[model samples]
Target: MKFDVAVVGASPAGLSAAASSARTDARTVLIDRDLTSVPNANTIFEGMASAACLNVEPFSIHQVRGMRLISPSGHSLEIDAGGHFLDRKGFYAHYLNSAADYGAEIIESEVRSVSRSADGMELFLSTGDVIDARIVIDAAGVDSQLASSLGIKTMRHPDDVAWAIEVDVRHPGIGEEDRFEYWVGSIAPGWKATFSPAGEDMATLGVFVRRHGRDVQRFLETFLKKFISRRAGSHPGLERMRILGTRRGGDPIAVLPGRIVDDGIMVTGGAAAQSGLAYSMRAGEICGDVAGRAALERDPSRERLSEYSRRWWRELGFEYILGRASLERLRSMSDDEIDRLFISLSGRNLLVPGGLWRKSANAAFQLTKAMPSMLPRFLLNLLRF
Candidate 1:
């Protein structure tokens, strides 16, 4: 089969790209190994709904008002943002249908090899079929084996990659107030543990660790026993909780790739290390539009495709950079230091990047009151280039 543009991976980014390209009158095709089993899809389901232009009401089960971060000492800080818990599988199907409705050909096959020639790009699939495209989009995600072959680099630092495991827990204490909880400093060193309520009496509790060889299950088990026991006295239903479903995967958490496009190709979504759902979708939108137009114009050169990278940075690059910096600083700090940092920054409305400038000023003032020695590091993050 031949197309003007072929998108690899049917992830939110890939689907959105296909949809955008097809809508622009480009003959677009999307291929994936398995479209339904998107590991990180649930990680940012609600945000993706808007970024990919999918409605969440049919699939969403709960609303999230904000995030709460807790330190080892139990000191906590809350940030307000609207979100929702969604039916992840349903969301993928919905996106696929949307792409198809926009006239994108959806194929369920693994890309065995990607070869570029003078004419265009040829993708060899596992089913012994060859698909051709004037331009190809690499949205194959963080673990994509095809990225390096295409000359796209992924996360560079070990600290930038995290392996996580999450399980569904049934507890009567789970509330409908829509809150996400983060346990730092104690649960998982270098990376934090998160609890997101999926619905009434059900929640997802997961832990992320920086090192690759570490056992995520053991950490999650220990955390469930220790942390839940600690809070069981206040919320008695925790003692009666049981696991419903479990999922685990390696997550690439890093700054966006330095370059996301090459001759006859463009990279989007997790494959570009723009792993956050909102960021990936927006980046995909830009890539798809640019690549679609480029394909239609019969010019898929790197120079023409560079606009996607430029536009992505202009829209959401700073947020990813700042977020990566923040995580790095947190990972470097000792548990005691993190406790102090959390305590110092507690009770302040901490919206990332938006209210960050003011929050940093307040954090500096409060750090001086609590742990004056760490003021420089805190200030460094806010003021660093």
Candidate 2:
């Protein structure tokens, strides 16, 4: 196969990269190990809105009113501008199809090795085929093989990595409400256990905990049992609810890498430590657009593609810094401290720190006043790390 641009990974970043490159009439090819298990970011409402901006439908989307934050003792706070819940499978399919529609060839194959020469880059595939492209985009997730092959370092440190487990459940009372519930407790220790609704009768319950010296399943189960037991009395449908499916993955909750562009290559999305769906989509679109123009000029050199790296950081670097600091602070907080943090922020706009911190200066100020003790941790992490 020969193309002007070859994108590795079929996730949001790679798909968008292919689409953008092809839009410039560049011969684009998107390669993935398997099309069926394309990873999902769970597609937040803002992300769906972005997909619309990119002219792609989410396939089937469920609107969520807001998120309800709960303390360890069960105090609750709800935010009004909640996010969207998406049909994961449908959204992935739509993204892939949209890329193909843009004249990007979709290929199902794994890259066995990667090499570069004066002419371009070459990828040897496990299917006993070779691919040639003038430029390469690595959008593979946390365990990115191509990035490694290109000598790119991991974006996150041990402390910045988290183990996440999500289980789908058919709970009668779960999605009946417009708001999702999040609980902070010992089971999830600094992090919160989340119950995100998918439909009237389906929801996803999950958590992400520090990856150091812990059993992922055991922690997940403990959180599930305690959370369900507490909410069961109120909902009355918890007694017979069964797990429909389970998914486990690593989460890189860290600042973006210092550089995402190298000779003949660009990296984006989770592989670049752009964690949230909205952040990843924005990064992907920017990188893709830049890569498309660079490929059109027949220049994939690091100096040429550095514009993509600079634009991403200029627009989103602050949020990524704050997000990393927030995650680190959450990990350092005691259970009681987590409870206090939630209680103080309860009913006050629910501007939860990770993705939601960028909204409302007043909310951010109020939170600082409420949890003055966490400031040191946040600053220390931001400065030291």
Candidate 3:
């Protein structure tokens, strides 16, 4: 088969890339192992949903008003951040349908490898078929075969990738909660234990452990026990809380790959360490639009495709830097320090309603007042960008 742009993986990034490319009148194809597979449930902020043009109302299972951050010592801070818990299957289906509507072809086959062809690029599929394309976008999650084939290192270190284990369960106490809960500090080590309610009687409990040696199950078990006891006020209903399903994967949180675009290929999503859903989708759109124009102009060189990289870095680079720095600072702190910090900021609204700069400034002010010692290090981290 031949195409102007070929996107590997059916993740949000790939779907948006295919759709965006096709919208530009490019012949786009999206390939994946299983196009119908349901993804793990996730939350997205309202601003991101707007940026991605996603209709959250139709697919949202729960409307979130804020987040509760619980320190290891049980100190809590609430931040008003509007978002929604989406039904993953419905959300994926919506994107899939939209991509098709935009005239992008869908292939239910795994891409075994991608190689540069004389004219463009060739995708060798598991089905023994080859696809030729002027440009290729790799969005195959963290363990990306295409990125590996091209020698692009998306994760800088083991600690940059978080092993996550999550499960959906039915519990009486988890009913249509407006806030997502995060238990931070030693329990989950480099990350946090999360409780995201998906409306009536259903919620997901998960733990993301960084630099963990494939023993995330243990962390999940520990988190479950603590979460149940804390939320239900007892362990009496623990046995009755039926687990519906489990999902496990690697989430690239801290570092992104040094390179995302090459001679005729670009990488996005987890493959490029673009972790968040909205962020990945936006990256995909930028990548696809650039690739589509480059392909149409018959110039798929790295120099031409670098526009995607430049645009992405301009739009989302600050946010990624800020988030990574914050995570690093949190990882450096002890449970007692986190508890004290949370206590200091307990009643304050951290999510100031304004632009990113204003909100970041407000957060910096509040955090400096709470933990004056951290200001120098945090400022140093930001300056590195």
List the candidate 3 regions with Cα displacement exceeding 4 Å.
234-236
Q: In lDDT terms, how accurate is model 1?
A: 0.76
In candidate 2, what are the lDDT values of residues 1-385, reduced to their tens digit? 7888888988777777778777878888999999899564653654335532643234445567776767666666777654677767777788788789989999999988888977788989999999988888888876787877878663756355666888888877676667767676565543656777877788888877764444478778788778778877667868678899898876666544645888888888778877766667678778878887888899988999899988887777766777677666766667788778877876565444433334635555776888887766677877864
lDDT score, candidate 2: 0.74
TM-score of each predicted structure versus truth: 0.88, 0.90, 0.96
Error of 3 at 244 (Å): 0.7
Ranking by lDDT: 3, 1, 2
Model 3, residue 44: C-alpha shift (Å)? 2.0
Which has the higher TM-score value, candidate number 2 or candidate number 3?
Answer: 3
Model 1 is weakest, by summed lDDT over 10 consecutive residues, at 348-357
Model 3: per-residue Cα lDDT over 31-147, one tens digit each = 999887775648777877775666677888788998888898787788787889888988899999999999999999988888888999999999999999999999888877787
TM-score of 2: 0.90
Taking all chains together, the TM-score of candidate 1 against the true structure is 0.88
- Please count the clashing residue pairs in each candidate, in the order shown: 0, 1, 0
